[model samples]
Target chain A: MALDDPRATPPPDDPAAREADAARLIGDERLPCGRLVSHAWEQARAAGDQPDPHMDGCAFCRQAVEGLTALDSTTRTLWAERPSARTVADRVMRAVRAEVRLGRMLPLDDPTRELRIAETAAAKVLRRAADRVPGVRAASCRLTPAEGSTRVTIAMTLAVTLDRPLPGRAAEVRRAVAHAAEQELGLAVSTIDLRIASVLEPLKPTASDEPTLRDGSGR
Target chain B: MTAVRTASVERTAARAALAVPGVSELQPSLRQSLAEAATRVRRTLGSAAPSPETGIHAERAPRTGAWHVEVRCVLDEDRRALDTARDVRESVGSAVDAYATRHGIPGPVTVVVTVTRTTGHRPSHHPGTTAP
Candidate 1:
């Protein structure tokens, strides 16, 4: 039987006041719908809480609640799913702490925010400088901030022609690059570490090689 | 070929040295130490006055052959000034030796130890007098 049906049996009344109680129980205070849903909604709203309209009147809220309920039901239908309340609480607390730490490490409008930008610019400059140097073939540079100073370390492969004296010139180039970085960027150049990748060899002329032709005519 | 062999040897020697007793830490290279020294000196001079006898100063000298290490540390204990200096020298030397043996390099390790501050008692002032 539907709970709201007027024919539904009411709870047994006290025998001493059965006559008076029956009339009171049948009054407007006795809602047709089941008391469980109504009582829960009233209590939630009385505490200045938002009522889930699925349990009340609004269709949108009802639809949303019904969707969530359907999802839960589907999951349960597929498998027996149960999770401890403590585990959920712990996961939530850990997520909150991690977010707080992340927020502190990267606050908006921090002055140090420019440090990343400056480092990127400096890396580009170093790469350009290394490219200009005759012996350095391909170079990669890293700039790190350390204790009020910046350290730039470079790794590169040297050209075959410059391989013999690369080490000596490498130190000089590092110094020049570091000096340029400090003078131009106003950053304290702490150290410049250089690593040689590999030495390239020039192609040699061979008897089997054919001479190039201009306009399809052999020269 | 010889240069590659030498580099390998030096690396082996450096690793060996690190295993020695009283060795604290081994740096990948000496450039870090030099940079640290520069930082220490800048910080010391930019702040209040250091002690008279033991002010911030960096000394760099060649060790075995190619490697150089710089030490930048504070020294505040006034009574053990000599001990502190000796300890700094020994620690730096040991670290360099450790690195050289590990790398198998036979070069001297140059070490520069700087006493940034002397750890002694601060001068006491009169109870209620204000300096003019």
Candidate 2:
């Protein structure tokens, strides 16, 4: 600005005055290029679609104008559409939900190798394995890394039908779980400890019933 | 230059991992993505979710020249997660190794695969068949 301009700052000889002007400048809107967007906006408004030489010469000023133009377009758009608050909330919530994740991880084969899986995710798979046994419904399945090794110990609570002996059912579940761990997931099963939580009325005559399972017909 | 190579390798790794069976989807490392979002001055201006180039991080050790890669993914619930992740690790490793070999970047590429979550679908397991 020219020294005479009323909007110009007082001489820099007075540090306090310069600091105050600097503070005011910061409160104003600026483009990514560090130029005041409002000045370029005013020039654009005055030119009435004609490109001005000052803004054309300045990269920062041109950037400011483009940003202001986007803002103006957005303003007109928002005003014209007046979208519902629900729409805005849905959009925001979708983004928030997308980012809401990450949990305890379990190592795959070798801890040194860095292959891992989400702890809960792995647990769910293991639990489902136990649940696959006829008349066995696994309620709780927990996995913890055995100290100093990549192998994991599984502790599960099962509810099985009274038709079969508890030991027999438990053995079946252990086999199923162990097979799943080693074959399907490539997880090392250290030990599968089971707690018979509750006995339930046997599930209605599925072909792979307890008798079939007991006969070793169930795979 | 390091960033460019890392990005290139990460992209290749992501593509390879996605193609592997049982890899339902890929996700950014929560910590890395959070740090990026936090450091930026504008939060609302961020990209939407499930965007490409977020999940895989590949970096070359300055001294050893060994490239360390981390992959985060969501596995298909019906498929085995461990085997899937192992496959992912191998797939990513092989793809990255090829990229390194082509670029003539030094050092072996080692990949660590992480399962972030699994897809919700769990098909009913057949009674006579061993559960997957």
Residue A154, candidate 1: how far off, in angstroms?
6.4
TM-score of each: 0.24, 0.63
Models, CA RMSD each: 27.4, 10.9
TM-score of chain B of 2: 0.79
For each candidate, what's the DockQ? Answer: 0.01, 0.30
Task: Report, for every candidate in turn, its global Cα lDDT versus the true structure.
Answer: 0.38, 0.68
Candidate 1 lDDT score at position B19: 39
lDDT of 2 by residue, A1-219 (tens): 111222333454665444433323334677665556656655655564565787667777765555545544433344344445665555555545555533356677765747887767777777888877877777787888866778888889877678767777777788888877775566887888999876766545564444223334342
**Index of the highest-TM-score prediction:** 2
lDDT tens readout by residue for model 1, B1-132: 154543443344334333334233332223333334334433333443422212122222335256554433333432232244345455546655665566565466554433322233423221222211
lDDT for model 2, on a 0 to 1 scale? 0.68
Evaluated with lDDT, which candidate comes out highest? 2
TM-scores of chain B alone in all candidate structures, in the order given: 0.40, 0.79
